[model samples]
Target chain A: MKKVFAREEYCLGCKLCEVYCVTSHSRSKDVVKAHKSEEITPAVIIESGENLSFALQCRHCDDAPCVRACITGAMQKDPETGIVKYDENKCVGCWTCIMTCPYGAVKRDEYNRNIISKCDLCSETGEPACAANCPNNALVYKEQEEEGE
Target chain B: MSLSLKNPEFLIERNYDRCINCQVCERQCANDSHYYDEEMDKMLSKDENCVNCQRCVTLCPANALSIRQYPLEYRKNSNWTGEMINNIYKQAESGGVLLTGMGNPTPKKIYWDHILLNASQVTNPSIDPLREPMELKTFLGRKPGKLEFDENGNPFPLPPQLELDTPIMFSAMSFGSISINACRSLARAATASGIMYNTGEGGLHQDLYQYKENTIVQVASGRFGVHQEYLEAGAAIEIKIGQGAKPGIGGHLPGEKVGDEVSRTRMIPLGTDALSPAPHHDIYSIEDLRQLIYALKEATDYTKPVSVKISAVHNVAAIATGIATAGADIISIDGYRGGTGAAPTLIRDNVGIPIELALAAVDERLRREGLRDQVSLVIGGTIRNSADIVKAIALGADTVYIASAALIAMGCHMCQKCYTGKCNWGIATQQPDLVKRLNPEIGEERLKNLIRGWSLEIKEMLGGMGINAIESLRGNRLMLRGIDLNERELAVLGIKHAGE
Candidate 1:
């Protein structure tokens, strides 16, 4: 499975990743106004608590429960990359996938559109934008076999 | 306005009643602004020679003294504000970006203006740049000792020349820190100007490949975005030993700024920390530097020239000698006041020596060692105008590189906040929208215009000096005379004070 790993030690807390992620998903790509608008919500949020602050995003799983729990067929695994992708067109405004996923990867837009949004692995670009722009080399995109085998 | 005697020693005044004598002011002044004249039994001021860094005023324990213009003024011209007149002239000629190098070129008492250039009136005929063909072109690379010819009478082998159409070239700046747009603009400008733009320590972007002939890629300590292909993709390779700003410190591109494109170019994973080590791990001694230089030479099949760039430190003469001996084709010396995309404000303002002193010392050392012509010299940091360029050449530089000046031509305001990456001028920011605002076409044209303007002025100055060629001015120290300089300063510069 392709996973995003963070070397939390190297994170400088610049928050550029969060801005990029939000812009990539938002309709306008305007960072300052995106947070307040109900139509768009950032797919990834940086969790800040006590000495640690890190970006939280979907970890595309091998056997994903979000895909199985989607009653409206909104979530599905790509056969090629095993990446769980959320389709807004078929999402049917249900929160089943959001409540059922073990990793809480599913999130809704600010407008209560009921359409789920999650990390799509940036498969189109071959590398995650969030991980690409991190200055500290704190993030890496690698397959399990390549990383371990 | 009343005119006081412009003696260098009597330029300052100190109020002892207001003076706490805490010595904080003395400690902060890099130019020794405040000193106790033991024989005179009073504190003294060295105001006339001060560069006006203002460190002493800000750090003074008691608000005892203030340094201001010595209250001398010329008749004011109300018809045009200085900035307005300059902007009008800049816009009229190029319809391009108003590119300039060094600090603000506003109306200041530039030392060059006070020193006049002599012309040949009775002895030699003055050549006009417009009518007579003048060669403003400069080649910055090692010259071969002798030509080698094959059996067929064809020259067998010789080093390639960094054929710059003009003497001006873009100085080094990295890719990861500066936006790709800025790099692209520099590449396009360099190509158009028939000059070269250095890649700084940052690796080259794939998109810049089209302008490879005009690119001078740099290999800095961080080795970020460097690979074999990256090494071969430039007209010349520069090994960045030091930068004028923050000379001894390494660069840190905060992870936040390491976008995917930067990470990809740098060969590091995206979003990871990109740390440029302080010094090259592979290079230790001069011999080690040679190994790296030869290694690059081998990598590129000796097709490209290798330049070594270093900051002008106190021992720059010795360092430059070592670099020349290390088989570098060119030696670029950056002075202390050089500009940078991002460096600690403290380091940028405090470190390194001035180019004037460094250049003279290096030239003297190289000439003494019988290796003056072994390497080409390119000096930068703060080369403000054509006059400074001529002065630099006389001090032994073959050519000069400019960065901050170029950026200003491309609309950089010099807000001194390049590290934020939210540069309003789009020269230093990575934000896509801001980057696009620079418009590379205008940037390129502006740079071309700036160089063209400077080249004409340089030719005029050289012609006025009774020297028709730029090369004739190089290392001709007899042409310079230091004004208002002490004996030691004059000795170091290898020139006599005016009226000596």
Candidate 2:
């Protein structure tokens, strides 16, 4: 399956992933427009330690825990795409998925206040905005090869 | 005129002159702080929802966004302040314990700031790091007090050691709490930098086995993913008794993060709670701990040094003594202010002592008892900068473990929202989208840069003391002087008050 992998050694901790992520999700999809007026909550985040920095997002594991933990069935894993999907309408904001997620990747969608937000791999573009915009290719979207070297 | 029952902690302001109404804040804020009113042809903001992660502010291309603490006022009561009143209201409504993330935000006594280093005057000539051969190489293992020679009159081999180019090692932050990319970054950095990165109880990932030589695989109470092969793969083994953040508590990895890879590494069922029991079931007493330590030694054929990691709790000095006598080659003391993926608010904030005091006490006790040569001391729990590293060594630490600083180098903003599982910075989350945000390739370089910078700083500090090697500075308390410290504090620290 094609997935985004982090090359942490090259990350500069610029957090431009967050910027592009917000802009991609904005109404106009224009960087300037998003920055000037919108309060876009970035689905992707950058974590920088004193000596290391990298962007973090959803891993979309095959046996996703968020899907299993959602009390309202608001969270689901796409069998075809291997993505964890969230349904805002079905969500009761119980935050069970949030509590169960070990990665701290599912966020509360503050706009609705009752729905959770996560990365959907930017299905429309077939590439994550953060990865697409990464200057150093620290975040890359690619398929994994079969094990055994 | 009346105060609202609750108020937003932060205020969001937009510079209209700079704003082009791009609506970036609306798109970036998961908290829904910004919205565009198409009918009004204007942008609007709701201050109540801002978590102040600064995502909108940082990503703003126009540089139009600003967030600040909301200046809402309450009657000034010293004892029952606004924050206290809010906490009471929250508890009354939710009846749940308030949880926080990251390190202790409250200002406390940071001994590093109060203690100053002494420089050479005339008797000793100070050396410059740029011109002199200053050494920061550190070895973490038992050092023989007296050299034992074989029949050939040559000194016998010393105990196994984890040799490092610098006196620093990345602390144990498991794969479950942080992403694989974060772990890989640390591993790669450690390998390249010639130090070590710990694989906190979460076991070693299959991809990381290549960096095994630089890895310190931890065997915590849970014994998660511990196997014979796992034991043989690392340079050293660390038996984790407790963590600095929650000393008596066990680790809790939410079921949502227990995916296949994590499940495999941890040897737990997918979508199940990965709880590390508070105490190692087999180790209730010091003797039990010794048995486990030896068992590990036997398993690894004693090729690797065994380290026992414990939180710096009360009587740490005595506890450390027991550990050294129990046959641990290295003793790691994590102080109260250490970082964790998630910890109970009460224990994280209240339990455990500062690493500074614990290190000083343990070093003193061990030296006095003539057991100092039997084990190496590694201290951690917010060792911030190079100065703190120097200070820790002079206070008797063989080396220091750094987690928060390493996380910062990788791009963590210290939002302390790790429990939420929605870490915007990828360092601490496992969700595929978030985890991928941290590219190990880039993360490793940043880590290398940070360590290189700190190593230089350490060398400079050593030179300023007119010392050419790091060994000469270890436990050299005379080079340190205390300011605004009591006589008892100074005496315990084994340093004289300034101007004495």
Candidate 3:
């Protein structure tokens, strides 16, 4: 499957990926309206320093740890997409998956503490919003089949 | 002790309803124009700090930001305008010459707008570029007066030439003035487009040495990076006498911009100012210029063409003739509205002449002296579009150089704050944070797209003129007519009035 990857050298640390990701995951699917009305929490997190930055999201490992770490059976790895999918209703808000995530791609809902926030790579949108809206092309959505995995 | 007289030039407006206090604008602004007030729980702006580069406005997710010219006006006097008063106030405060970036912003007469191109009528049908094989390829170098043959009927080798896929080139913009990314972008674009890009006085960086075939290394008065390897690495060498932005003046690259790479490339001490003196101290006369040109020719073993670049001033026609006679293979003339990283505002605004007249005059003079074929004419300073390229060819130019347009292709908003060393667009700054904003891959792609688009437009125009090759359009003044120009202006441009 194609995945989202970040070329950190070109990242401008503008956090525009977060803005676009939040807008894509929002109810209204509008930039201004989603940023203004809804509580915005982007699935993609930008790890930034004084002069360097890169977007971080779920790597979707073949042997996903978040799926195994979920206590309430809320997290499950979809066999087809190799994605660690999250079910909000089945979660007990114990934050076990957040602690187990080595990449720290998991986040808790700010308003509702019952569920966890994670990345689905915007499956319905075909391409990740962060990669699509990147002004510098630092984030790209591509297939890593050439890696010989 | 606490008195000031200058006012802010721009006013920043933000829509509070749309702004969620995301702080993106605050973080993106290199000028620190926007800040979040903890006490008021609102975003505020320091409009005075804004140079109006539009980075914040473009990056604002909510589309809530807009910049407007500050409505500060004078008491209805044309003699002492607001800018004039503000300039006086700034000089009174600093006691230093006013410096600006970019080209002249005055309402100067643009000859390109006054001139109109020709199209084929009922007599000769215009060729459709889409269906026909139009030729835009051009070679810039001296053409031998006559072909010599040996006993075997094999002709002697022609002079070295710079083959261009289009009649446009990225003009000289040094690395110290712009970021390395910008340089790399232009270099990559030039290499991809089969054109050339000049390395303005700043020595060629090590990474760009791979593109030597598409490079035109320049040796200015400073001779910053002029060495054997550097001279031989380029396809051609250009002796830069003056620039259009500030003719007859020197250049200064501040100490802070001389980083390790720039220091290594320019052969200057780290954190030391790179100063280019006004004139080549050794070049006192045309004879002196000829000696230098010959020296360069000798250094390159006469393999690379040597070009002489000068500002379009009052006596440009005579000067160009002298340069051609000095054995220069090419003569590049820059008009008054050219670009610069930093120049005194007075010189940039009031120094040089328009290139249209200068080009016409130089072509006329060279032809009169029977030296036209001995050298190729390349004009620059402000080549805005494909139409400008077509018009320049019709005005007797082999090619046109474009710096500001190329910079714009790589994302230069032209805020005129390049000397500040804090360019947010990553085109004219050394700041790593800002410089990384310009990805060379993206820059290269945008520039190629620009060249491709312009080449298409050029072919369409050439097809409309009933010309299949760009060389046929050179010095074809019959295809151009003046719109609102007087007889003297038309005569200088060597073109007739519209009705005529």
Candidate 4:
């Protein structure tokens, strides 16, 4: 399973992951235009503590609570890739996924308050933009064997 | 003529391209928004039945479903808002009062954001928490009135204290309000973090007895399952006179939620209404409160400190003085924006004073009365981040209690739907299927991470202030300045303008 892991100790709290995420998900896929003109909301958020900061995103667990708690079945994990995905079309905007995501990874898409948005591992690029753009490698995307399998 | 009601809130759409005639949405929807059409071999939906919970969306295998808010707009009238009209219609239909949960969501001035912290620039050297020891350790209890030495030059005997490695504590979330898994997560996290978690009104579960050293069992008006053994199974005891969410009111756990497990935990009859009284009938006066405090001390043999929790009201300073004089070792003040399992919407949004003003007033009053040293102040309402904690300490709180933040860490979305007992996140539900959604292991890890993150941030803030210990920050309003506050607010907060 491919998952994103946060190494909080190494994080600089720069929030580059958030910036890259917005650009990657932008319609034009241009960083400057996405930031300057577009109203973009990044899927990843960076939280800073006393002397430390780190980026947090969806962990895409094998058994995700968001999927279970979602009353309308808007949140689902891919059977093949183990990627936790959001179907905006199926979303009813109840915010159950937002409540169920422990990491606070799922967010209300500002453009459409009715649909919850989250990290999709940047499926188009085959790798997460946040992990790729991380200056300190604080966020890493890696594939691992299933625990029981 | 009867007014025409608004249209259904949500619009459910199903794509036939990928759908293989599955009926999972029909089975998963608690609101019964979906149903299978046997004759057509297809799925149909009723928009009015859906509350947009998104359960079926997550369970769908074909990934061909979508739901959106109905794009129906009434004639725009700023004076008559949609919510106002909808609420009026709802009340007209049901003839019942609105009930809500969690903290207040209405936009209001958050004092923590207006206040700015001062940092050491040149003269005072900033201490690096990484290199030097930054003491977040705190002791919650009555402090000695004076420093006295024995004949052998030993310090005087100290009162009972709840020692913590950090000043942050996980606030109250009763077992009945939240699931056992949620409580277990908090218990394990408290033990691991060397802090404390309160068993708010709800009696402690027997399985959590092992974490008694880090637990704060409460004795609310309901006295749900408070017994001799329950009193002794905690580091301290909190007498909950009121909660911040719904001040001057009681909590009601519907009979439907009073299942066998909740019944056993609360020591109440199954299917009985577990209503906590608004006031402790015995505590009519300060003297009466004192009597209860002493009674609890005697029950625990003076081994545990006694805390009195009250909502922040207009006369909070005077109320705090009475509580302190009544011999409460710790006085916990909950602000207006505190969370609750359930509360009347009217009371939750429009009652009680803010914690910031209340904490400042109480601290100033206690100090002026020369009784500040006798008790520890633990404040809560909406303590959101580490900066807020630092701000609280500067405002004179010994430590801060956190409930909503901790719940968020455990997967609460602040949807204010807890009163419905349909909390999909599992933290505030009694339903077996829903409650199982919260895994204790994951909950604990998330809580630990949140606290650890906050601790690091707190230490860094301390370092910026050139302070090495949290004690130095307590009651030090000089370290804080109000940026946008007026003269009255600044005076009330006891802080100067940011530029001043």
lDDT of 1: 0.73
The sequence of per-residue lDDT tens digits that candidate 4 reaches over residues B1-500 is 27557568789888776554446567455466888889987788999876666656654545668888787877899888776688788777778988889997767888999999999998999989999999999999999977899999998779999899888999998998998989999999999999999999989888999999999999999999999999999999999999999999988999988998889989999999999988999989999999999999999999889999999999999999999999999999999999999998888889998899999999999999999998999999999999999999999999999999999888776757788888766678887656655768778999999999999999999999999999999999999999888899999899999888
lDDT of 1 by residue, B344-383 (tens): 5446655677778888899899989978777899999887
lDDT of 2 by residue, A62-121 (tens): 788888888888888988888888777999989898788877888887566777778888
Put the candidates in DockQ order, highest first. 3, 2, 4, 1
* Every model's DockQ: 0.01, 0.10, 0.79, 0.02
CAPRI grade, predicted model 2: incorrect
Per-model TM-score versus the true fold: 0.61, 0.78, 0.98, 0.74
User: Candidate 4: deviation at residue B10, Å?
Assistant: 5.0
Ranking, lDDT, top scorer first: 3, 4, 2, 1
Write candidate 3's Cα lDDT for B115-233 as tens digits: 99999999998999999999999999999989999999999999999899999989999999999999999999999999999999999999999999999999999999889999988
Global local distance difference test of model 2: 0.86
Alpha carbon lDDT of each predicted model: 0.73, 0.86, 0.92, 0.86
* lDDT, candidate 4, at B435: 67
Evaluate model 4: give its TM-score.
Answer: 0.74
Residue-level lDDT for B417 in candidate 1: 54
Interface RMSD of each: 19.1, 7.8, 1.2, 17.2
Q: What is the lDDT of residue B99 in candidate 4?
A: 88
